[model samples]
Target: MKKIAILLALSVALSAPAWAATKAVTLSISGMTCGVCPITVRTALQRVPGVEKVGIDEAKKQVTITYDYSKTNVQALTRATKDAGYPSSIKQGERDHG
Candidate 1:
């Protein structure tokens, strides 16, 4: 009976799809020198289907976004930012110096 229960549990676990991973991405944004810039970025990013959260740092000219990889990607996020008129790109590993 124990062996059967363990097998059933293992089968159930293996049948379930693993949850997607979330990644933190920083984007360099241009034309965000004013207060509205952050708002614009936040609104745009939130519209994305998989974006979990967004944070914009005006002083650093960076926008941090948390998203599920399966639903969205960096390229799509960057394009969304650009479409909002902020014009953004991935910050790579570190914050932008500009």
Candidate 2:
């Protein structure tokens, strides 16, 4: 019975989703020239599949994004923003939220 319990626990652990790893990065957004720019940028970023959070500063032309690392990557994030009419580039430093 003890062996069976141990196996079950191990199986559960292995089956659990490994996509919890989160990455946070500040993106420099270009082409935001008006009051409605932030809204567009926010909407664009939120549309990404794994984006968990988005923080936008219109004055600074920056957007901070937190997303699941396994389901998405930096390229996809940038592409999404660009496709939304706000081109983005990853900043120099990155933060990892575990």
Candidate 3:
């Protein structure tokens, strides 16, 4: 019975999806001239498939996003913001934080 339980646990661990690895990044956004710009940016980012959380700082024109690394990437995040009419790039000196 113990052996069976151990095997079950191992199997469960192995079956976990790669998306279990999450990462956070901060981005500097441009063209955010008014209140509605943040709303648009948030909507666009949320539409991404693996975005787990989004924190926007309108006063600083920056946003922090926590996302599933296996399902999405920095390029995708930047593209989303660009498509929403707010271009974005990784904040200087900010590295990926998991």
Winner of 1 and 2 under lDDT? 2
Estimate the Cα RMSD of every predicted model relative to the unseen true structure. 5.0, 3.4, 3.0
Instruction: For residues 28-61, write the lDDT of model 1, one tens digit per residue.
Output: 8867998888998899999998888888788989
TM-score of 2: 0.76
Q: Compared with the true structure, what per-residue lDDT tens digits does model 3 show for residues 1-98?
A: 99999999998888897429999999999688898998999999999999999999988899999999999999999999998888899999998789
Question: Ranking under lDDT, best-scoring first?
Answer: 3, 2, 1
lDDT of each: 0.83, 0.83, 0.92
TM-score order of candidates, best first? 3, 2, 1
Estimate the TM-score for candidate 3: 0.83
Model 1 residue 97 CA deviation (Å) reads 19
The better-scoring model by TM-score among 1 and 3 is 3
lDDT value for model 1:
0.83
**Candidate 2: pairs in clash:** none
Separately for all candidates shown, the number of backbone clashes (residues 3 or more apart, or on different chains) is 0, 0, 0
